[model samples]
Target: MFEQAYGRLVCFADGQREIIAMQWKQGATCAVHDHGATASGRVHLVVGALVEERFSFDGQRLCHTTTLHHVAPCTIEVPPGLIHRMTASPDATLTLSIHHYEPCIASMRIYDPEGRRTVIVPDDCGAWIPEDAAAIVAIEPWSAP
Candidate 1:
């Protein structure tokens, strides 16, 4: 079964684990964010292509670590607390992927490098800031690699 959640499709969910489906339009990018500290997951790209930016967060600053370009038919293991952002390849009409999380993500921390701020948001918001935007929890600087 599937339902909508955080602008994506929730393929399945139980208190301990969940699977989500994401669709990306050409040139679309998700916010930089980390899966909850206790959650670990894998992202399986089913179609199209994507560009992924990985980051590291020290207590005081967020820093870009590396970037990767992935084509479809690939899988990425997401370590706990890994911070990253994903963008659909500009040449792709659509990009699709499935994400599986254990202990299902309860909340996530989104980083805004340009604004130098970080916000704690509920899982329903995915890696994006919600329209209400009353969830800011930290203000920190960021640096590029």
Candidate 2:
């Protein structure tokens, strides 16, 4: 259980989208995990720096890893079920980022080093703010009415 804090930035009910800001101190790391079946995500760095790694698994073994280093003002797109992990750089002051989820993340799976899987219900984290009716929309305007 790595230490970190989450703050809800915004959300839309009918549209099924949300933005959550996460704060991480030096040495912090997010557990390797996947977004829910219907969800995709994008993370935008707001402060300091961190690393993101995408992994592929064969049976129970991890393989084909890809990594990205993100500093403030950068963004990365993540597809649903894409096993990934994030870590704050050791020299970082503090890492802050806003995570965007589509079709809203209901549940996700966390993976242990041995490839063991644990279902994590997002609601259980207790890090959400009440949904606002007048928040800025997350979808692209080209698709809007």
Candidate 3:
């Protein structure tokens, strides 16, 4: 389970004209389980590592899992057109100043995969829902959703 959270800054699609700041603490993360809406997404990390776990959804089925670890002061880009699942590091206290330079909307969904059903938590909300991503996918890109 994610015992640590993430800090976020949002940028629009047309250009960098918006600066929306969102932050969370330990044992928290965006539970929407998603990624950007384009082929390229960029972010300037100020602090903290954002732990992202990737997955493949076959419409009615969710396949594979990959856990990506990203530290602060770093820029992460997901290849254009890939459905992604992301989460913040569950390590400890950390912070990140995200400068959304290229206009990317990162989303994530949280659930207890080992539980009874699919628990898809929407974006813009923070919650602690941890499942072993490696148990579902094969590669861990180590970035945010």
Best by lDDT: 1
Listed in order, each prediction's TM-score against the native is: 0.86, 0.72, 0.52
lDDT of 2 at 74: 88
lDDT of 3 by residue, 1-145 (tens): 5453455444333543334454546545554344334424454556666776666754444455777777776876655544454454567465554434234333333433434233333333333343544333222222222
lDDT per residue (tens digit) for residues 10-110 in model 1 = 98998899999988767778888898789999999999898899999875577899999899999998998899998888898778999999979866888
lDDT assessment of candidate 2:
0.62
Query: Tens digits of per-residue lDDT for model 2 on 2-119?
Result: 3343434454344678777777768667666667577788888888888888887554555548888888888988887788878788897777788788877765655544324343
Candidate 3 Cα misplacement greater than 4 A, ranges: 1-20, 36-39, 97-145
Best by TM-score: 1
Sort by TM-score, best first: 1, 2, 3
What ranges in model 2 sit over 4 Å off?
1-15, 124-145
State each candidate's clash count: 0, 0, 22
Q: After superposition, how far is residue 16 of candidate 2 from its true place, in Å?
A: 0.5
Show model 1 residue runs off by greater than 4 Å: 1-6, 134-145
